[model samples]
Target: MYHEQHGAPAVAPLAGFTVGVTAARRADELGALLQRRGAAVLHAPALRIVPLADDGELLAATKELIDNPPDVVVATTAIGFRGWVEAADGWGFGEELLACLRGVELLARGPKVKGAIRAAGLTEEWSPTSESMAEVLDRLLDEGVADRRVALQLHGEPLPGFVEALRAGGAEVVVVPVYRWMPPEDLAPLDRLLDATVGRSLDAVTFTSAPAAASLFSRAEDRGMLPQLLDALAHDVLPACVGPVTALPLQAVGLDTVQP
Candidate 1:
């Protein structure tokens, strides 16, 4: 196993290093890969999946829509839509849910999501050039969303900010968060990983998503260990991000990310 130096101009694998894995439910998937590659794995799930509120609001929204479906739906994630479909089923509105969007304005966010939509037997009415949310927002804005009834099937945490933005543009947004991304309610297990990183005990850390990186640093910051962890990552430890989004926040901390 070779050691990697910071800004070394390579995205090589660290075979003999210990890394903090920050995937949510798929931590094991990543952990298994790291183990197979000969890296000591620190299983730290920076995100947890939470179902949306079971409030009757969604049911009422479904009933009203079934009786009188709307003009468009902004299905940001296909995974979220499946959950929405299942949730609506228990409420006995799955057919209503599908029928409502049979031939209305439909916008897909990303290929991953679009794949899910297609597998669910739905075709795209409109697809964006990019997978970013802001881009999707721009598309909707350009087309004029004022007084438009748009349903948001969000998978992440509260985007009240997004809601406000849509409202500002005159879109009547009704949201159903199929899932949420949250830190481990208990950080006890991560304490060891944090200690190893802060004490310079780890050789590297791998981040799978932007939120994973953000959550780790934010928690370290809140616990007064940000300096140590940041130092370890930038000067002594290697940081690998799965994609561009995960790499963005790494730059703010003065460390560039290596994607593998």
Candidate 2:
């Protein structure tokens, strides 16, 4: 109708703009969303999600928990929690793991984690509505973790200071590494994205996770373009993140972001 009235179609908000996507999972979906807004999307996954199913580390941790049975179990993310159970299921100990967790004080970091726990036929003793690991940590400290065995299910990378703080409080913390964040096997696309970023060719870059942001910065540093990349991001390129957590890496380097 507007086109009919004006003899031309409305201009898309993102028309003539280029955006770089750095997500490994659901990258196509994100790129599609950006493209729908008329943005020229450049997809370069900064990192890859490596599941630890065959890595033996996850099995070892699962076995340790089954044998030792931690006093408190903290589920940090829905996918991580689900992946742990799925991996255990593949190893023929899913039910055993659930039974062990049933006896401990289970804690969920947010609603999604709570859903995963419930889906696994278990219930959380408590969950923070704020969806914050910090809040969960504070509660654990307040409840006194001295001499307590706590099993923390990590999503990808370690939560900054969380394990250290728990250990400092005399809690025997067993880290369950369900998955890992590794640099993408193919670095060519990432290199191209970095070049575009440093050249100020891209209008914006999207980060879905903190690891992706960190990986991008690491790559830039490795190529000796950190300063130039930082300058471009600071002045010309817009860094957009899914949430505050995903923005941590960018913020750590003294850069601001647009969270949507």
Candidate 3:
């Protein structure tokens, strides 16, 4: 199909499609990619990334780590790891933290985190190629975590069964809570997107993270439109996810999703 709009051709693969984006980080880049394919982009950030309070638990954790460095450090996400280091820098313990980390066995969840570790003048002893935390846990267990001090860097939410498993192995697990996800301060755009989804005005919705998916569901329930939203998502609108982890929230509710 071809349409002439202001002397331009709308013959792209996604022409005539309107896609909804719910990612807060890199939303502009994702939106531009969809638009380049001729799809009308509806940008609605479902959640916002908020760093934890400066003088709160993060500072306490940093001080404790400096006083008692862990035997092993697991860096999960690149951004979260960097944020932790930068936050420590703000507290005037950046060099001390770096020196402490240099003495521990560092494990990066994936390449991005490995880069973050290396960028901080540290090297990772190991990293999983599949980028699965399960693999990292397995390595830790197989190598023996008993009687070891392990520090885990959290991205947003706690990893289910991760800390529990470490504790079960008799390892002292210290969770480094970094950034967290909160509902966007401006809900107008999200409200509009919700309305469009229920009205069948959106052809597809893209999810980059599980929290965004869950936040959308929570907002729909708050408005008492859960059934309507679920019906539209189940029948009319296509749900596109970036990866399997991001698809978990949708899958848990029996919603089919495409990863592309």
Which candidate leads the pack in lDDT?
2
For 65-149, candidate 1 gives per-residue lDDT tens digits of 6776666777876677777777788777777678787867877888877787777678877777667677777888898889888
TM-score of 3: 0.88
- Candidate 2 per-residue lDDT over residues 168-190, each given as its tens digit: 99999999987888999999999
Worst 10 residues of 3 by lDDT: 49-58
lDDT of 3 by residue, 1-260 (tens): 57799999668899899999999989999999988888999999999887655437788888899999999999998988999999998888999999999999999999999999999999999999978889999999999999999999987667768899999999999998887788999999999999999999999999998889999999999999889998999999999999876887898899999995
Descending-lDDT candidate ranking: 2, 3, 1
Q: TM-score-based ranking, best first?
A: 2, 3, 1
- What is the Cα-based lDDT of residue 187 in candidate 3? 94
What is candidate 2's TM-score against the reference?
0.94
Evaluation by lDDT, superior candidate among 2 and 3: 2
The C-alpha stretches of model 1 lying farther than 4 A from their native spots are: 1-13, 51-70, 158-164, 209-211, 230-239, 244-260
Q: What TM-score does model 1 achieve against the real structure?
A: 0.76
Whole-model Cα lDDT of every candidate shown, in order: 0.74, 0.92, 0.91
